[model samples]
Target: MNSIGRAPNDQTADGGLLGLSQRLPPSNAAAEQALLGALLANNKAYERVAEFLIPEHFIDPIHGRIFQAIVRRIEAGQLADAITLRGEFEHSGLLDEVGGTAYLAQLLTAMVGIINAGEYGRAIHDAWIRRQLIDVGETVVNNAFGRDPELDGTKQIEAAEETLFKLATEKGQDGGFVTFERALTDAISVAEKAFHRTGAVSGLTTGLRDLDKKTGGLHPSDLLILAGRPAMGKTALATKIAFGAARSLLVQGRETGTMPRGSVAFFSLEMSAEQLATRLLSEESRVSGERIRRGEIGQKEFDRFVQVSRELQALPLHIDDTPAISLSAMRTRCRRLARTKGLSLVVVDYLQLMRPAVGTKPDNRVLEISMITQGLKAIAKELDVPVLALSQLSRQVESREDKRPQLSDLRESGSIEQDADAVMFVYRDEYYLQQRMPKDTMFDSADKFHVAMEAWQHKMELAHNKAELLLEKQRHGPTGKIDLFFEGEFTRFADLDTVHGV
Candidate 1:
């Protein structure tokens, strides 16, 4: 038998299976050399890969240093050839380390063609990615072997995910400066879209008419904070917006006869996916969520509920109900969704329920919240999608006579307010007015009690079914209150009309 056909236990002259284990990590030395040669031959080739290919992507240290030196000279508008680079290295007393001028000249011969620079650069970058993945795998294995005692199984998984995410995004193509002319062209395109679309909305529709008019719809790359106290319908309003975005995507897809380019992602940290679906069903079917849960619906209502659910199933909306989800996990999931389904919007039910990236130990609650908010904003910018994160108001909003929420009322106000592009509060006067009903026992006379009760009833009638959306901080536009119709039974929100019940 040949030595190549030896058994697993066999230690032949070639070292058998052990030799395979000792293989070098992924790398492309020739590709690196070709890319460097292309750049040294013609500096214009640098522009082709400058956005994504960094010097660190090279396999050999000498190649990396040469690329870096070339980059410096080219960026400074100077010639970067074998002679220029050698002078640079000699001046820095590193010519011997970089194989001297002879090596620089040899790189010139290594070039296949300058036109293939982009391809060669990409190959080097791909090798670098593979190398990074191998390193990540090694770290994960080491951690699993109890290298990090503080990291439990779940935390180790989170750490691994975070590391991979960092690797994927650190040199991603999502960032770069846009020329003013290009930016202006994009702005004009948005304006043109608004001019042709109904309601003049240049962004994704929130399904609320007044809100759409005020904010020009839920814009991409914006971090909008929707804040309110308990029982104020923060989740309901956020769900409404998410559902609205999904419905819009569906309509566009139907019009075009192809899948829409994007979908909505709702991260319900406080509620289960089923519960959020129930609320959406209730809003659409005009049936109460509580009644649906209690099985109090009649045959007709059940039929309607099922029909609405079927229709909703066609919409491009996704829900994640992972309680206390870490920021990195949410980012990882969003990236997956964006890659697979094309993400348009992200809604975090409430930021307070979210934890920062695993392995981070914040010193205080404020710092923790700051990290969470900053991470959320980063996700929005990274994915180029809107992030509508729900927030809780501080108890201080209750101490005042007016229960309307202010920017200061935001829990962890400093970070939440500062990080958000816009801040809005959902306020329903009926909730507070109903609690202050006058009692006859507190009055000295029957007439006095009757008068107080009448005034209270009038106020209730005025506030009933009416909600206000206070746009407290809008970095892009004016801040004002938008009137909305709130259905308490179904937990639905719509544009309010004074003459008609909408």
Candidate 2:
């Protein structure tokens, strides 16, 4: 049998591959041979390319088997020269299929130098990547030709995009260890930036002073879960963060007379883009969005709204109001945004409404939620930006006497709690206390009812215009409650005055 596999369409007078140009995929057989030869000559050469290249990257099947055998022997604390590899292959009944001892000797002739092993391995890996791309293209074409009847055209597009993204990110075997010295250098850089910053905020600031002091701003590659029950200002809080980041980016750009690298991406799965914008306008103009919609604003208020809208037109905040968007679609859009305009933060307003990747039908709701959280975390890491995902709390919080949300109150708590780097709950005691006011009909006497009502009014007064951000889980910092002032009319949150001790 031929050592090089015979090509069916390349039969000629000498049975060579002169006419096999149209039949072969992209491959570098010579480079594979050179890399394997170097490995056989000196096992130390493997360290140069071990982080990026593997045996499957080889073009020839025999070469891949030989590389695997050599790796196995070397990793087992044995010398892996030509003689030892040949013996091991012979014992495993693979020597003859790998062109026997003669082919092994010929590889030594193919050896160029041990120093070039990394280059050769890279060449082989590049060819492998090309081959994979070809395969992906072919699969896309075949699926488009009615191979999968279950997927419609839009879903097929999502599937194709998902497959391409997977190959783009997960194809190469890269990123090994880093030295402790390099890590210390990064830490020192963060410290230096914090020292120079006005408020010592090391990461992206949330624009709330107490929250910034407690959390030190939003760090890159962090998955921060902002969760709460209904009517607890979860959407309002997320919108606040997105607005703050965008405003900061714009202000920094203007002050430095340079382009800013920070921008905000808000994914509003529940609300329309217009509604989100209106909320921001109301917060800035101190006018009620409900009244604006009802045309109850006077001339002065309308002019203020117009002026605030004009000012906010320059903020680099992008909103996507797509309902129930899948994770892959979000990733694709984020990547596109990052490519065209820089991205610093991503906000997904309510994670429960998001679907997993297309064509992934999990067996249960828990697994589906797990996949979605993992995807969100992966997006955070891949883009090297903070992802603030809003989540819903279970109704069990309503039954609790304290009404302060705990970690267990998170809807689909398992994956969400596990995957999040930090978990925060928005709690308003005023909301719960408002429901506890006693009525005249329920009390035995007017005096008793008035006493209960007075007690309830005092409790509401204590909790009014206040909201608590309970940090139940933080991977890198302390966990406690940070008080914030909430305006019910504007649906806005601000740093509470610490001197008065709210």
The numbered model that scores best in lDDT is 1
lDDT of candidate 2 over 168-227, digit per residue (tens)? 655654557867887999999999988999898999989888888888899999999999
Q: Once model 1 is optimally superposed onto the true structure by TM-score, how far is the C-alpha of residue 291 displaced, in angstroms? A: 3.6
State the C-alpha lDDT per candidate: 0.89, 0.87
lDDT of 2: 0.87
Rate residue 115 of model 2 by lDDT.
Answer: 100
Tell me the spans in candidate 2 whose CA falls farther than 4 Å from its real position: 1-173, 500-502
- What does candidate 1's lDDT look like per residue over 359-404, in tens digits? 7999999999999999999999878899999999889988999889
> Estimated TM-score per prediction?
0.81, 0.73
